[model samples]
Target: MAEISGVVERIWRYPVKSTGGERLDTVEVDGRGLAGDRLYAVRDGSGRLGSGKNTRRFRRMDGLLRLGSRLGPRLGAPQLLDPLGSPVEDADAFLRAYLEREDVALAREDAVPHFDQLPVSVLTTATLDWVRAAVPAAVVDERRFRPNILLRTPAGTPPFVEDTWFGREGRVRGGVRLAFVRSSERCAMTGLAQPGLPHAPEILRAITLAHDGRLDALATVARPGRLRVGDAMALA
Candidate 1:
């Protein structure tokens, strides 16, 4: 019998890669992952994808995190929001100005989502707490890791429990099934300065040195369905 492992504490979807994302009370899961997650990305003049993981491009694309993206009423259409949280009518101009690169343009993902590695990433609060204990100075926000699902593990569970979940099948609310693939690799973007968050290099260092540069677990959809906050996750 499957046992309760954790409860979904949060759901996040990034319409644009390397930028701010939207938090939802409920979301749909598919083979591609959350419906609007990573549907759009900023493509540079050289045709390289603008991602915080790509340090060279990301350095030039500073303040990318200040821009927020949300899906419009229409599917695959995203609305850009400025740092002040105001809708930007001319998204191209606004993004170019924000990134300080005239050659950069917002592009939509084609057949596949613009994911760095896996389609979905999951993290547990116990792991976050352990990281906070390791690096008390850094702000250990879930946004830094960019996880799609943040699960609240039972109190006192050992840190990095998700590591054990690798290769297992997780059922969400007895509907959605996810196959845990591997642990997510950390990147330089975790140290980048974002809105209300200061740049803290130690955050990445702590994960690298102690956790082998991995924290969250990556997964792919096994059975597409609905996911909501407070949904219980069971593993088989």
Candidate 2:
């Protein structure tokens, strides 16, 4: 196996699925993934979870990105916050009003995983640069991809460098080991409008034309431990 190394540039956790997430300086990685990541989501009466697309388990629910979730003073207790960062008094009522559908309500993941594919999503700075190079007119932001871990590779590193980490086990300086399963497939959600980003379908179009619509790595925790923004990552 080849050796690959870099520094953890950023860590993000989405308390609720398909919504804006909170960036952390440090986090705990357990068997499932980053603590408090995608444990809850807006579910409809038909049992389909709110998502950017319609699937057997997910329903196309617009405006989910307009909301944000924050971890309480302690982890595990996640609260849904409005875009402005105010706690919503009534989650169901707020969701109903925001989504404009009475059948929509907030729900937690049980029995099944709430993640789109894998528990953890990893994106590297080089990949973002690749996207920017492909679509220079569009805003290339990490939030558009919503990765749990953002790695900053050394200068002059080639784009999509994470592809080499696929099917490999990586150890972080903080002791978290992850097995990169596969490259994550990009979806329409990447083009959806977020707080600081506009609705840019060109980004997804460019990805589809250049990279078959895949942009990041999806992995699972191989060993539970801690991770921080400045931690070093080594892949074997």
Candidate 3:
């Protein structure tokens, strides 16, 4: 008893996580990810990714805490630099400093590093509500989702609905088209204990258990564009 509904709400990017977010008025669409989202990351000698699924192994790596603010979508094209604006001639040396350990160099100039999977990430209000109701303890904010796009769909729709979005594009007013991909898989990161949140996993577990063992979110464009707020999402 449901029908296709346009995006009731959407989020275009993140300014700082574990802190606050910068809601966009409109954004461009790209393949790699939102026009300019998480272009740079802070990885130390301890090469590991913080994917909202696991964290026990996170100790090996450090300093990534700063990436949330240091990265730019392009960082002036390629050559990803730190927040301080230094040329990372040796990304290893640049990142290893935080580990206070040694360099592993898991990053790539041609790929997205320190990120869980794709450059863009997404989630839904419905799905988030489900998680909150189940755990009733953790702080399940968009930071946990780390998504560039946060969708609010028609009521009663399934959670992690991105899987159904393949071959479809979320349009904005009439300027850009942000497409959707398959569902994201869940991992131990989602179960991790955010320094202040005790019941974080109980919340994530709700989604994992509800939707088989996968995490649900959305992905968008990689190129930058001029997207206006109040755009309409139309599946193509």
Find the candidate with the highest lDDT and give its number: 2
- The CA lDDT of each predicted structure is 0.86, 0.88, 0.51
Comparing 1 and 3 on TM-score, the stronger one: 1
- What candidate 1 gets wrong by more than 4 Å, as runs, is 55-60
| Models sorted by TM-score, best on top | 2, 1, 3
What lDDT tens digits, residue by residue, belong to model 3 across residues 1-236?
22344463666564322212346756655555554454433333454442232364333232332332333444342342454444456655755664454644433333433345555665777676777776676677655655566666777876556677665655555455555666677654455443333335565567667777665544556234555544445666
Per-residue C-alpha lDDT of model 2 across residues 1-236, encoded as one tens digit per residue: 53657889999999889989999999989998998899888999999999999999999889889889978646665788887778898888999988889998877779998998999988989889888888888887899999998899888988887788888988887889999989888899999998878899999898898878888888989999999998888888
How many steric clashes between backbone atoms does each model show? Answer: 0, 0, 20
List the candidate 2 regions with Cα displacement exceeding 4 Å. 1-4
lDDT of 2 at 205: 91
lDDT tens digits, residue span 1-236, model 1: 78889999999999988888889999889778888898888888786777765554343466788778898645557888898788889888988887778988888887655888899999999998898899998887898888999999999899999999988988987389999989988877888887777898899999999989998889999999999999999999
Pairs that clash in candidate 1: none
The numbered model that scores best in TM-score is 2
Regions of model 3 farther than 4 Å from truth: 1-4, 8-23, 43-67, 70-98, 102-108, 111-116, 193-199, 217-225
- What's the residue-level lDDT of 128 in candidate 2? 90
What is the alpha-carbon lDDT of model 3 when measured against the actual structure?
0.51
What TM-score quantifies how close candidate 2 is to the native fold?
0.96
Judge candidate 1 at residue 209 and give its lDDT: 94
